[model samples]
Target: MQSTDVTQRFLFDNADARGQLVSLELAYREVLAKHDYPEPIRALLGEMLAASVLLSTAIKFDGLLILQARSSGPLSTLMVECSSDQELRGIARYADDITGDDLTDLMPDGVLAITIDPDDGQRYQGIVPLEGGTLAGALEGYFANSEQLPTQFRLVADGRVARGFMLQSLPPDRQTDPEQRAATWEHLSILANTLSAEELISLDNQTVLRRLYHEEDIRLFDSGPVIFKCSCSAERSGNAIVSLGREDALALLDERGGEVAVDCQFCNASYRFDRDALEELFEAAEERARGLH
Candidate 1:
């Protein structure tokens, strides 16, 4: 909220549950900087962006955490990506005027999915029904049913900023004192939920921490920085074109004036490739297949 994306982890000295608080500002603004989105769509992006960071708090992954939603309404797609380092990026696609309401109102029957892709492993996905009133409640239900952990989330997005907090219970074996763990989780959840939009978007990370946990023995960990970044490049675009098959690519490129133009839908960045580029891609694909054999 202090003009930056900051992720902080906190532990309760005498409790079995842990928590994380993540706030955003500059990165959130950067997400909307490249295009002119409608007011409602922008706010929806903020909500999804905040929820992604909050979900990443308790996830143990070293690569990417992608949150996506594809709906049937005028607002079609929304996506937010977070890395182990808390770096984040997001964008939304929707009509200019999208009924003007909250997330549930806009996306009534869509599915919210979170994909965790580790540094060197298979990707795992979890789907959550977008039934509840707020995105926060929907994710809380997700944790309870899928992860089997009592989790609480507080997501706040406004003023072109996105932020959230999460409290997760440890494994039962570690939570020998069930009452204490429950008490600690409730204490933190209440404080986190009471956070104001100003506190989430205007104050620094530590200030927010102190304001929320000053009376408790909450231990703070190393701070992680987050930013808005889309991993789109010319090489990736070329690979995608190659996957489309050389004949089709060549035909399309020929129709488009001897060059292929591809746009990265997430960041709205354009990549252009002339005939030579496609030739090179096909050649490389062939060489890779041969080497594999």
Candidate 2:
């Protein structure tokens, strides 16, 4: 049975702990649809995508989880993002002659940056050193240092799918059952580590969960849909131009044959804005400002 890109949260009824089973099939392919990434880079994207989704389910925030990294070596930047809704997207920037062996080595001394942005409040971001450790290790370190939780995660991204599984102790204040938390998290992780890329990319959610935790009493919640969507459009891109001011906006139009092209790096979706498009967008802003005055 084939599984869709489904992220299911499970709560140990009496164990006082929580977990998530995430399997990405078509969703992973959607992310890699148009991008050409090396094997290692593809694997990294898978890890980050799953990590981002895990973070979304673990935390109670309503916003975005962005995983970004920059290296001083060959692979300049690698990024992946997942939202509270389980929507995921990511890409890797590499040179034409990059090899799998060279890709992991490329970020020997880079920095891993994770940003948590809420829709109704200020955004917070954390950065950690990427010292020879994999993306999962770096994020685990982030949780230890920031949230101080005993978190175990397995992130897998293959050519066909990217999925991640996570187990974490409930906050002491939330449950106040230390023994229960330990037993639950430990048992779930013991089984979770057995997951393979083939299983994650192909099996159905129910089948995958049964294979890992058939005997456990887990309450599966509503799965938020996950998809490959670009939040870019001509109106939004032109608003960016308006922020840059009318002079710069006209300059861009002249530079790009009377139309400005705004491309989203994640999905590679382009939004084109010509003179008239820019004029309307700028006019709306001006009118709003005038009304405020």
Candidate 1 regions off by >4 Å? 1-3, 172-175
Worst 10 residues of 1 by lDDT: 172-181
Tell me the number of clashing residue pairs for each predicted model: 0, 0
lDDT, residue 102, candidate 2: 37
The true-versus-predicted C-alpha distance at residue 242 of model 2, in Å, is 0.9
What would the TM-scores of all predictions be?
0.91, 0.87
Which candidate ranks first by TM-score, i.e. highest?
1
- Overall local distance difference test of candidate 1: 0.81
User: How much lDDT does each candidate structure score?
Assistant: 0.81, 0.76
Pairs of colliding residues, candidate 1: none
Q: Encode model 2's per-residue lDDT on 1-293: one tens digit a residue.
A: 43477788877676656777676767777778868777777777777777878888887889888888998766778887788887777888876776545335877668998898899898989898875367777777878888888777767776667777777766665446667656666777778778876786677666877888788777878776677666667677767788989888899789889988888777788888889988888899999999998
What is candidate 1's lDDT per residue for 160-190, written digit by digit as tens? 6777877777775545776876776778778
Q: In model 1, how many backbone clashes occur?
A: 0
Question: Given candidate 2, what's the lDDT at residue 183?
Answer: 67
Return the TM-score for candidate 2, rounded to 2 decimals.
Answer: 0.87
